[model samples]
Target: MSEIATSEAAHPAHLQHHFDSLQEQSQVASLGMWVFLVTEILFFGGMFTSYLVYRSTYPDAFAIASKHTVILIGAVNTAVLITSSLTMALAVFASSEGNRKSTVNFLTATWVLGFTFLVLKGIEYTIDFHEHLVPGAGFQMAGTNPGHAELFFSLYFIMTGIHALHMIIGLSVLLVILYMARRGDFSPEYHSPVEVMGLYWHFVDIIWIFLFPLLYLIDRHR
Candidate 1:
């Protein structure tokens, strides 16, 4: 028992002063991340509820507005985000396996994919501007109540804009992780940062998953 205790006392360099063991540290980090995620869910939940109310109040207008959205761009961005999530998962796996090269490769791929999504989104926004879909003065829609249609556009801009902001933040975090990864800052036993970042990336991707169908596919049957 004394020998076991002595061996356990030898902490890894990555272990913080507040943590007694790697396991304890990992648990704390994971718990913190989950708590943060819960708060994020609540934050987004309010907007979602607002969306539901507005959508319900103006279903026809919402449907018409959704039809004007760039479905092709939304679909392509969805695919990009999903693929990025897969790469992020691979990055976490590589980190856990102590393969620095693989981790860096996968993280780079994820970052590139995220950047591509943003570029495509920017193009979509430019198209929206050209189409006069900006939801205020100069906004235009046909065969629906323009006021309700404007509301739909308002929600569209707010939801998707917030989502893009999260994507940018996620990409920035990935950049920091990539730099640290290149420096061999992580190991199989101390890759909690990578794991937590993966959680965040996945969460962002999931948000887009919801947004795609809501914002793009609501009027497909028409």
Candidate 2:
């Protein structure tokens, strides 16, 4: 514990005097990070499991439906998400270094990248909608396996919908943290909000990572 304290606290302000040592703070932060990760896993886990069930049941429908999705768009979005994750980590690193300017720059970059991902997602959905790929919105498929196609698309929308909801919530939280960073509220000693937000942002990226392969990779088996 003393070792942990020595490593984390470069100054008194960084180590909460009330907490006895930096080790305690680090331990608490690590614990909280793990708990949050569990919830994230559970969230995406449900989606992944559901997708497998449907894919198993409607193999051909799943394959054909996947073709309708813009694989290139999904791939580009994945790359964008990866860049956001990088910026988020860099922002956290900036906070640790107490480089307020760098921290703000990184945060702003991350926020912009995240929004770009959303915009790309919107365009993808638009394409899906125009082609009648959207489920429950006058969705259609003709010949061969229209019934199974609907089932595949239904699962696609539900999973992606939940993921998009998470991204919006994450963006809101990130904006709040961004505001705080601008106010000079975060520092090496006090950056809980940024750290937590980083956890959330990373989790969202991971969810999309899975989503990309599941939705886009079904065709590879053929």
Candidate 3:
């Protein structure tokens, strides 16, 4: 107990007054992030449930709409996000080791990969718009069930649009973290921010992992 108290007293920089020690602070931060992510999961869960319900109701239409999605771009974006997750992990690891240079480099790589994903998605969205997939007066899909197909596209846009927003936010946070790393703000003893942001980034990547097959690979064998 004396040793722990001494260590905590030594590192007053990042330790909050409310927390007894940096370890305690980091644990609380992780718990808070988990709680926040749970709410996020529930929020997304509603959309996923809606998707399942509607997809079951209109399998044929959903399949047809899925086919219209740009699978190549979707696949490439998946790869990009998956790679970004790796880079993010490396960034966290580097921060934990107090390797400032590696931390910055890895975070930059993750940011670049994330930006690439959004850019590819932008291109995909453009193609979708040109193809009249945007569910409106100009919407067009060659099928007997254009109404249901539009519904599929509607969900697709909402889910992915919100996801893209999250990605943008994550990128912004990454920039902040990168700046901090450049300033030597993180160290082996104090890198919780990097670690916590890594969790958020991974969660975002996992969402895409589920989304790719559901939105782009449905009935592709046909």
- CA lDDT scores, all candidates in order: 0.91, 0.84, 0.92
Candidate 3 ranges with C-alpha deviation above 4 Å:
1-11
Q: What lDDT score is found at residue 60 in candidate 3?
A: 90
Residue 180, candidate 1: Cα error in Å is: 0.5
Candidate 2 whole-model C-alpha lDDT, 0 to 1 = 0.84
* Off by more than 4 A, model 2: 1-18
Global CA lDDT computed for model 3: 0.92
Candidate 2 lDDT tens digits, 112-157 = 9999998998999899889987766588886548778888888888
State the lDDT of candidate 1 residue by residue for 1-222, as single tens digits.
113334444856677767788889988998899899999888888888999999998899899889999999999999999999999999999999999999999999999999999999999999999998998899988899999998988988999999999999999989999999999999888999999999999998988999899889977788
Number of clashes in every candidate structure? Answer: 0, 0, 0
Q: What is the lDDT of residue 161 in candidate 3?
A: 94
Angstrom error of the Cα, residue 103, model 3: value is 0.3
Candidate 2 — worst ten consecutive residues by lDDT sum? Answer: 1-10
Choose the strongest candidate by lDDT.
3
